[model samples]
Target: MSTFLNLLVYGLADGAILALAALGFVLIYKATSVINFAQGEFLLVGAYMFYTAFVVLGLPLVAAVLVGVVVATLIGVLVERFILRPMIGEDPISIIMVTIGLSMLLKALVQMFYGTSPKSQPAILPRSSVEFLGATVPLNRLLVILIAAVVLTAFTIFFRRSRHGIAMRAVADDQQAAMTMGISVRRIFALAWVLAAVSALIAGVLLADISAVDQNLAGFGLMVFPVVILGGLDSVPGTIVGGLIIGLLTQFVSGYQDPGLATVVPYVVLVLILLVRPYGLFGETRIERV
Candidate 1:
């Protein structure tokens, strides 16, 4: 029972980060109909930036984090404005190729400056472990869960009440119609990219807090696909639920079975979900008449 509880605790925290990263993917897809392959690179850049500011520049933790987020957001804006914006209306495959190239470029840039070694992030959260629900867990892990929950709730409220959020929903529903309604589709695209960067930065910082900062950190971005696919790519709530499901499965597999299974489980789940429901759990289904 203790072991089970421990797995659950770890799983929930991991899922929260997954959901946060996946949120970035869903937001841009909903707004611009593009899947950013560079999303993970955004995480890498943010984490490294935070490391530099806090450790190298000796900035306060809060200021360092904020600066990292701003730089990440700027990267997103520039990418959207310069690279992706011009490619508007291009084929999905072409856009995908460009993003793949961008991810590689970003990775090379990080390596050039940060080198190929891992760096331990200066402790930003409490290092002490606390017992919870029969299991000992790091305080920082609990903090990650609380922060993710708060952010998710805030996102829900924003979508429901904020004017910009409504406009985003409108654009997602029908870009042409939203433009007709004067939503400024282009501006919404930029805003979506910025918000996506914010999500990536938050996830990156939290993950860095848990582990060390390195190239491997970006690997979490690939995990986002399973979460988004299971939850429904365009459904924010689905993303949260999907993250939990994937997180639990991963923890359970690693705990009881083989550790390697944890890495493979998400893709297996993705295939199963796709086979049963191609549109995902919350994603809308489209029908075409011939």
Candidate 2:
């Protein structure tokens, strides 16, 4: 039916953003084994930066994107070097606590500067509607979907072909072995954070284009945990799968049933995944011969 098709298109479009956001979480977890609860704040930072650049300074969109990325990457690197680095040997709980603290601190800072009020983003991309298979759709949404696909493909190739990407894989597999092979584990950790931050920037910009830019944009990162878990925390490409699955499921349910179901579906799926397949669909399985 046309209605089903409409929901499907919208779902796929939204999934693209989910995949982008979850990729950041996966990158940090895969490389450094550190869970970054502050990842959402990075999105907050990106959205604000884009707002300042595009709306306030009236810079060109491309220039604004570059500015957001640079600033976000710098913040990520700083967090790794100054905050996370000092707790390298600390227990996992301590690290998690630190991340929580960092998130709160970042949120407070963002509030102080940007305030709690939501700001509608300027339409950087062209504003137009197009018909797709009997469904009316926004051109911006289509562009976002295309951009997400391109970015995902490019990163997949980078991970498979690039030296640093290979190095990251090596570290993720075995830190000791990677170091033995002359790979700097510390450097790779920093790179993971940088990549994570950059991913957040892209997600933030795309999301702002779709919705209002606000502090609540930070919550988008929470939606990513389910995607990461469902796709496999260590699997890079699985992000797309998980993102699509969740995005489609939420949209489909909300479209067919009650709108309230949309927000609850991801969490329900998350719990089920935790109960049934905690390792996730594409997550690597390891066995220890005792």
Candidate 3:
């Protein structure tokens, strides 16, 4: 029972981070209809930026976070403006190829600057354990869950109530109609990238806090694909549901089976989900008359 409880807590924390990463992916897809292969690289860049600021420059935690966010925002804007903007009307395959190139470029840049090594990440959350429901839960893990909840809630409110958020949704629904309504699709695209970058930044920092700052952080970001696919590629709420499911499943597999199996399980689930429901659990089904 205690083991199960521990796994539950750990899984939830992992899922929260997954959801954060996946949220950005969903936002970009919804707003731009473009799948960003470089989303994981964003996570890598954000984590490294935070590491440089906090560990290298010896800045306060808050300041380090701000630095990371600002840098990520800039990266988002630059990518959208310079790289993506030029290819706006290009073939989807070309856009995807460009993003793949972008990912490699970003990863190479990080490697060039930081080298391919793991750095000791300072603990931002309390590194203690607390008993919950007869289970010993790491205080840091609990704090991660709390922080992710707050951030997700804030995003949900923004999407539901804010004017810009409504415009974003409008654009996502129909670009032509949104344009007719006087909504700037280009501006929304930029905003989507910015939001995605910020979300990835937060997820990267939280993940680094739990683990170490390493190039493998980007690999963790790749796991967001399974989460978003499981939840629904364009469904924001689905990201949360998918994240929790994947997180719990990974934990359970690792605990009861081999830890190695946990790594393969998500992809396995991805395949099964694709075969059974390509649209995902909460993804909307589109029907077009050919």
Deviating ranges (above 4 Å) for candidate 1:
286-290
Candidate 2 lands at a TM-score of: 0.96
Candidate 2 has its poorest 10 consecutive residues by lDDT at: 120-129
Candidate 2 — which pairs collide?
none
- For candidate 1, the TM-score is 0.96
lDDT of 3 by residue, 127-225 (tens): 999989888989999899999999999999999999999999999998999999899999999999999999999999999899989988899988998
Candidate 2, RMSD to the unseen true structure: 1.4
lDDT of 2 by residue, 1-290 (tens): 77887687778877888898889889988987888888788888888988998888888888988898898889889989999999999999999999989989988998998899998666876788888887777788778889989988888888999999999999998899999999999899899999898888898888888887898788977888899899999888789999999989998999999889889999999999999999888988896798
lDDT of 1 by residue, 39-121 (tens): 88888887888899988898998899788888987988898899999999899999999999998999999999989899866
Error of 1 at 277 (Å): 1.0
Lowest summed lDDT over 10 consecutive residues: which window, candidate 1? 279-288
Weakest lDDT window of 10 consecutive positions for candidate 3: 280-289
257: Cα error in model 2, Å: 0.6
Deviation in Å, model 1, residue 160 alpha carbon: 1.4
Who is ahead in lDDT, 2 or 3? 3
Give the TM-scores of the predictions, in the order they appear. Answer: 0.96, 0.96, 0.97
Model 3 residue 281 lDDT?
97
Q: Between candidates 1 and 2, which one is better according to lDDT?
A: 1
